[model samples]
Target chain A: MKNSFSAMARREAAAGYLLVAPAILLFLLIGLFTVLFSIGLSFYHLGQGSLITSAKFAGLDNFQNFLFGRDLNLSRAFKQALVNNLWVLLSTLVVIPIALAIAVMLQRISKGIRLYRTVFLLPMVTSSVAIYYVWQGIYEPEGTLNKLLAAIGLDSLIAVNGWLGELHTALPALIVTVIWGSVPGMMILYFAGLQTVDPHLYEAAEMDGAGAWQKIYRITWPILRPITVICLIMGMNGALQIFDPVWIMTKGGPANATEVVNVLVYQQAFVNGDMGVANAMGWSIFVLTFVLSLISLRILRDKSE
Target chain B: MRGKHKWSPVWMLVLTMAVILTACGGNNGDSSTGSSDVKLTMWHWKVAFDPGFKAVADAFKAKTGITVVTQAFTPDDAYRQKLTGAASAGDMPDLYAYWAGPLEGAFDGKALEMGPELEKDAEWKNGFLPSALQGVTVSQANLDTWAADEKSSDWKKERKVGQIYGVPLDVGAFYTIYGNAKLLKEAGLEAKAPATIEDWIDTMNKVKEKSDVPGLVFSAKTFTLYENWFMNFVDYMKNGEESFTNFMNHDEKLSDPNHIHAIKIIEDLAKSGNILPGSVSLDIDPADQAFAQGKATYDIGGTFTYASLVAMGMNPDDIISFRVPAYADSKVPDAKVTPFPLVQMVVTQGGKHQKEALEFVKYLTSEEGQILYANGAFDLPAVKINDTSKLNGSLQAMAGSLSSESNWWSENSAISGKIGQPEWQTFHADMQKVILGNMTAAEAAEDFDKAAAAEKAKAQK
Candidate 1:
């Protein structure tokens, strides 16, 4: 095989390998190694302050503990977190359309489009921890949201315990924050997609007596269906792995109403120091996320192909 | 041309490997032990205590000609994460601070056993409060409990029953009630902590009546103070120590009338509109800030709270500290607050400078060092200070609150180990609801009892 290649070809091949070597090595060392290590860690019981070398082989016990109710508290927390993740995923139905609507409006605007876009993108650009703190203030008992509601004579609707403090309202309050943070990125994606849509389609829709709503329903939506699918996938992945906002805002508290898989994984790993179980929970969430993403892709796939 | 560039791939691989190795490797920063330049690193999560630690470290270096480097990580949870990462990497500092109780087990294999050294040096050993040492010591009850618990295999194996692993940095309790003297005087009440639970509430009511400020404030969102310390203290006052033990051991239920009464006391206080508004949303620092800013008439905290309150700009002269007051007609009316070690300084097994680290630990708990720390940080010391004038006014007040009483639930070795169980999560959540008036105290107590039963069953399995 070496003799089959010319000297010049061999030289080019060597150069190519050299150019990509760092990236390949980095991917193997940091990315693949950690994934493989955590997967292996799931099969072992490693307590805190003990090295990985001292880990005892536990077979499937770690997974069974949470998944099979061997540990009731862990199982209940895991199931509740799984349900919360699903709720977050379900919010994409509302999130994508709102983002698309904003994008459409931005596309139609003749002035200050940049300013509107920048204003809308501010949350995306700002530090998420800072934004969570800001939102925490807004949802506080004496926060702006409750005060605004009271000012408008809707005093009965106030959450006296604060939005994140009430069990009934915590998850929804979190979901709203999640949607607000997520809308900006999806809006930017949709805006880019809308830019590629030819202006003549709107003109054609108008000639056919299609109103603005009908124009969007019949033309814009169909053309942007692929973007919608992409947004749904991104949203699903983001929601499933969402940790920082929940951690900063509620800490999966008010009776674990805002608990998600990542928060549970964090608690198991760092708080409880049950590395094996934490890794098991992490891999389990990964499997669920993969399956959900794949199913959504299959369902959203165009049959015309 | 190919031959000229042949070493490029090999060179790049070497450089990347070197970079990764360099980044992954941690240096303990220890040199020859006898050398004057030998430095030992210590880590802790006490934000307000950083300056005090620095002053002590500087004094130690001047006395011994050895460097003691100190690093402070804040907010507690982040420091736990840091320790977890360091432990996994086998790169823990020479000395670090850790919590006692269930959390001490996590550092079993890593922390150096200082028992033999303490036993040998009677002068140094006797310098610390006896209760402080008892709190850090691994008792027979700890051994039995760890052996029985399915999750405590590492703890049972690595930690011996009759040995101590760390030195107490401070002895404190979270059940202390602090009153703002300014607010008390403004309400026309005595500028002192109320004598009993009823008295406290009555004082709070007076403050509310005289001014817009609430009667009481605490880190309600954190819930540990309300659900654990305050609840347990009230339980002891109302039902006695044996009843408290029975409830923890599952021989008695939280739904019992006495326990429900304890829960109802907290509920009644909340119902009285004495708790600060939006308290359910505030954690420790924010609640402290609210108290310091005079938004509340009184705050509930521990020995550590005095320093934190003073640091937050509250005048020490304007604050009165006392134990979480007992109930009127209480079973143990004369119950005094006994101090228990909260944070412990541990020498890491992986450190190169073990002797120097041990010496640093000794100096940190020495009388002179305690005075420097207590006066500088306005924090309580584990070691008793005969010279009360050496401590700040707030620190002295905190010190005066401690006694030799050992009949409380906190002092019970068997019950303390069970206090951190998972059932408390349900209890804490319910306690929040009880404060918010969404659930009756009896209902909350029933839920806690059910949760505890479920936990007990799981533990049995």
Candidate 2:
């Protein structure tokens, strides 16, 4: 019996190893290769040569250029992108909370919950490029938004055609579009998290003479903490990596007011043919994201404890 | 129990070994080249060139019997991004199209040389426009020349200022401007185009007052529109010398009286409310659509706009092409307009079939090919083979008028830097600022000078 037990344990162990082997191999092949290759390529000043034969190692020159060089416009672009992303992050924070409130209200209502959820979730499912185009049309001078504004007698107060062109309004314009597109998904997540809250705890709180606000503050909020953390981290990461909307709608224009790090990196790698600098920018973004994620995790942990 | 434990370890060891072996085998298999068939892939952004490319590919296949695949990308910018990504991945197309600008110079060394191919056909050199040929050529010697003079270094220097790098596909003369002739006639204006800046503005003002049509439809978002307009103004102001040289060599500032005067003119037009209300947000297509619908009386655009206007359902004869006026008192002789040519096909270094590619490029520049591009697409041939009879109705007359003149220049000739071409875009944006009343004409000029100087400094390094 002892021998059989030992044999069974050993077989299970072998099966576990076998099952995980392919995944490990894939991680090494695809993930490790790209990580190493990008790092290796970052060291070289590559132009006018094949990757294998022509790339000449310049040690930390590319990194230095990206950080402190004068010829490359990368540092300025990076700063601009970071600023733009900060706006996106702030907008997300504001929009997500509002969306969650709406979702919670709808969750308590039994009659139109399905219709409400579907309507709220529609923006999330729509294509980003299509949304950008629609938003662009809305923002145009004679577009729907301007016409509506005029119909309501606010035409003289605003410049209809230059919303995206204006320095003060360009980033805000993009932020509004982004918030409108992303709020639905976060709202849905909040709804799912709210559904998981224990009804018994609310019942007990009510017996203890707790009010609606008190129940929400003590029990519901605590239960939704993890979901909020997930949303915050994901939202920050997504905002940091924003490219498609800015690229399609603005091209970081109106005098580079809407320029972001990802867009700058793209222009460097592809438009400007400065791959070394682009890779450096990529690694910089990676480090930034890592630091941010760590900070977020620490905050979440502290709050939970 | 001892026997079972020992057997279990052996089984575990065997599984680990098998996994490691499989991984190693997979890695090895993946790296090996597949089947012997030599496949050559080419990528281009020219959708209009699809039929032409197909014909060439067929001809090449018939001659050498190699399977050549061509992919055409619409909306050129997106295609460029994809091609750039492919190049970074070391999976660039075997053949691709590239523009000759400071922007393209960033990838110059990576591009394949066609020096050997050019050596094979001397007649291939004769078919291109002298100016067009001068636009693409870059040489180490030319680089040395620019490097030799410290004083001249700050001036815009081309990558290869005078070398022919690519075959000239098409050349456009900047003389043409599309106007609502019916509106012009209603304004009590003659059928003839404006001869000077004063006449042009007067005509526009008249049209604005008399007709329901707006005076002009120009998109503020389009860099090309701003460039074409600004270049025509600058060209007439400076006569024929390159604007950069005038600024750099003669201490001529962008804030010079002539340039500021030009900005004021464009701004005045904007303030007149003669432009469409939301022209700032309108892109090239919708702006052109507005023009096509006769919402405006004038659209200062490319020679290709003539074709586009006709295609948009306007009578081709009703559309008359005119030269954009220079200064108020500027004579018609001094108002000679220069057009900018879009860069076409380039042969890359990674091209496996350079011989065939060169043959294909050569055929494209041939008289037969020129005639085909000209007749089929209404494109102006790069070579000055004055055969307007083959062209469409009104275009033939335009071509006839073009033959009566000499010394036409391309706006691209004004670009001096190998990587600082975005300054042109910036210049246009500054012009927008001036028009929007965000800045004065003097301020716009100063800003332009500063921006141009900064770009020049960046490119010099």
Supply DockQ values for each candidate.
0.25, 0.11
What is candidate 1's lDDT per residue for B381-437, written digit by digit as tens?
A: 989788988888767866886784444444565574466667777777777777777
lDDT of 2 by residue, A1-305 (tens): 99999999999999999999999999999999989988877787654212334455768877776577553344545676778877887886787787789778877999978898888888988887899989877766666776787889987745545567565677888888888888898888899888888899999999999999999989988877777888888888888888998888877766566878888878776655556767877887778877887888778763547
**lDDT tens digits by residue: candidate 2, B1-461:** 77655657788899999999765543121232322234567777777666656655554454445445878886765776676566656566666666643224224344555545666666766666655554455545346534542212222244444444455566565445688776777778875677666777778787788875668887666655656544544444544445534553324566786445646666788778677655655677777788888888888776667777877888765677776666654333454443334555665555666654555566666665566556654566665565656556755655555432324333234332321344455566666666565677677777667656755665565
Worst 10 residues of 1 chain B by lDDT: B26-35
lDDT of 2 at B126: 66
Fraction of reference contacts reproduced per prediction?
0.28, 0.16
Which CAPRI category fits model 2? Answer: incorrect
DockQ of 1: 0.25
